[model samples]
Target: MKQTTCRIRCVNALVLAGVIATTLAACSADPGATPTTEPTTAESTSPIDRFLTPTESVPPTAYPSATNSEQVANNVVSWYESGGEEQITGVRDRSKEIYSHHAEDNWSIDFSLFFDRSKEAQEYPPIPDRKTQAAWSTALKHVRSGASDIYMSNQLGIVRGSKEVKREAHGWKELAQGVKGLKAIEARLHREFGLDPLTSP
Candidate 1:
């Protein structure tokens, strides 16, 4: 009986890991893929609330579809690059559609210096500084995925922050200065994680 229980437990753990690996893999397909959302007017139909509050936590057994989350994030990024943040509350179109999509899963985004979903998480780690943010490749759960400074910079194409920005020398510029898209990221975060795809703003 004891041997059976141990076997079952190990099997269960492996199954769980496989499920997560599958979800993450599916989401990560075609990293360079473009947004599927058709372009529309930049006007936003999203209420201010979606960006402000955290999404209701799902049960641990309720795994998220990384693919869908990735799509939503991609659409929002397209909208943002075209100035979606500046064009809030206007005629509705592609921007509005994508924005609406994002609001549906705002947690998947990382707002960086713009929002504070970090405080909203039920089980989150302490806020990390610039150095730490750049190092962590895994997405943050409580905040969705869009809260880190380095994470968003990579999404916006300002810096090559595809992963951790490593260094310890003196001549390095401040994180804010190096990443021009940072302020835009932060402000939009004020507007909005998953997977820009890690969350800290």
Candidate 2:
């Protein structure tokens, strides 16, 4: 009976030795190595960086929309007659205010002569295609031959500045002398360029 007990103990010792040896081999095979299943090329990017890869821009430039207010304003006047250019030039003289702000984190943006100009659009070479026409681009246009009123949109609703050969801004709601034609301009701006006529300055 003593010999049988001795034999059972010897078998148990051999099984324990095998388990320790297998565990040690597995741990040493890849010391400090990352798991093979994880991805190595994963990355992250911010909202602004996406503009770098865009292929489309207003006026079709590889660079940003307008270098400065003067360039855009001048380009607009080129589409107008000499007398109209001189008149439109006077109002746009105020450092060329362009509206480009988006509020409440919404995709749609409001533009206004009441709102000051922002050069934020200049930073990017190619801006990402927007959901609507840029407000500043619409604001810059004037008739090459006919008359156009210099209108400003603010919280008080649409306001007309001037329509006659001479332009002037007298007050917020009322100014200038011409047909209601400027209203159509504002309407077209809102429709094509996302200018919320109701948006405040």
Candidate 3:
């Protein structure tokens, strides 16, 4: 009886060892069953990921698309170039139309400069109704000569304007600037104003 009991106990020990070994081997072989290290609950996220994650980022519905700055500036330049009063007026009107299309917090800096020039042109001559050819010439010269400077200034101004517009526009500008293959005026637009001039139809 003692020998039989001892033999039974040895068999039970062997069976337990075999069960444990098989379990470990199966766990290793089965990817789903394998034990995995859990990620820490306090893991950090990237700056970009944090920016992308949506929250209560409510921006104004009337927020104007900041894309029209350069175009409006060019149009103003076109106006001055037309030389014909009717055509110049038409160009100015079109520029106003472009400016009016979106709800800008204020006119873009370049656009504002153009507007001020136009206003000054309207106010030319001491008489309330008299027109001055000299004013027209001066306005055109100021606008044309300062085109590059105005563009650069406006590009930076748009970036400043964007801060007051909406959160999405602000964030879009930040991301678009980081994108590859953007530089010069195009990059400036994307970076400063969130306008993708290259891909827009």
Candidate 4:
């Protein structure tokens, strides 16, 4: 009876050991069964990733297009006669608003080239006569000067107050005269050259 009881005790110990081995093998085979700790703050977030992501930026305005002299002259006349006037007036109307941030951006892009006499000659076709050429030159200078005054006034933060107000009004007056001068010059050149004016779109 004692021998039988001892054999039975050994068998029971072996069965218990086998059960433990099976459980260990199952855990090893299925790693996903184990619970994982949450990631540390440093692992979950990175300053470089947060701040270095690429972002869209504003593009520079395209320069006005004109390949030849006649085209350049026509472009200048069209811009001054219509586009420039509309842009300046729009900006003036919106000067008191928050959304007028880029009010003076168009001046340099559209009109600056005409102010450079050498550049103007190189880019534009020759006017038919000395008289018309003189008129053209004067008109460009006036327009450039007037535009500069307006641009500078905005740049210098002279938007309000009585003195600055008067200065801005004066600038507007000069700009109007410049526009009128440009119109007259355009007409003379068109008549002299027999070139048709570009129709406003």
> Which residue pairs in candidate 2 have backbone atoms (N, alpha carbon, C) closer than 3 angstroms, thus clashing?
80-144
Error of 2 at 35 (Å): 2.7
lDDT of 4: 0.50
The 10-residue segment with the lowest total lDDT in model 3: 124-133
Candidates in order, TM-scores: namely 0.18, 0.24, 0.23, 0.36
RMSD of 2: 16.8
Clashes of each: 26, 1, 0, 2
Residue 133 of model 3 has an lDDT of: 33
The digit string of per-residue lDDT tens for model 4 on 130-182 reads 46556655655555555555556655444556765566456556556555665
Q: How close is candidate 1 to the true structure, as a TM-score?
A: 0.18
Answer with 1 or 3, whichever has the higher lDDT: 3
Question: How much is the lDDT of residue 65 in candidate 4?
Answer: 60
For model 2, the local distance difference test gives 0.34
In terms of lDDT, which candidate is stronger, 1 or 4? 4
Q: What is the Cα-based lDDT of residue 60 in candidate 1?
A: 30
- The Cα local distance difference test for each model comes to 0.35, 0.34, 0.40, 0.50
148-193: candidate 3 lDDT, tens digit per residue: 2323434543664554345434422332332211123233333543
* lDDT of candidate 2 over 1-201, digit per residue (tens): 999999999999998999999878777785775567755544355444556446322233332355765554443333222222222233333222221121233223233322231122222122122311242233333221111122322223534334421341222112211112334444543454344333221
How well does model 1 score by local distance difference test?
0.35
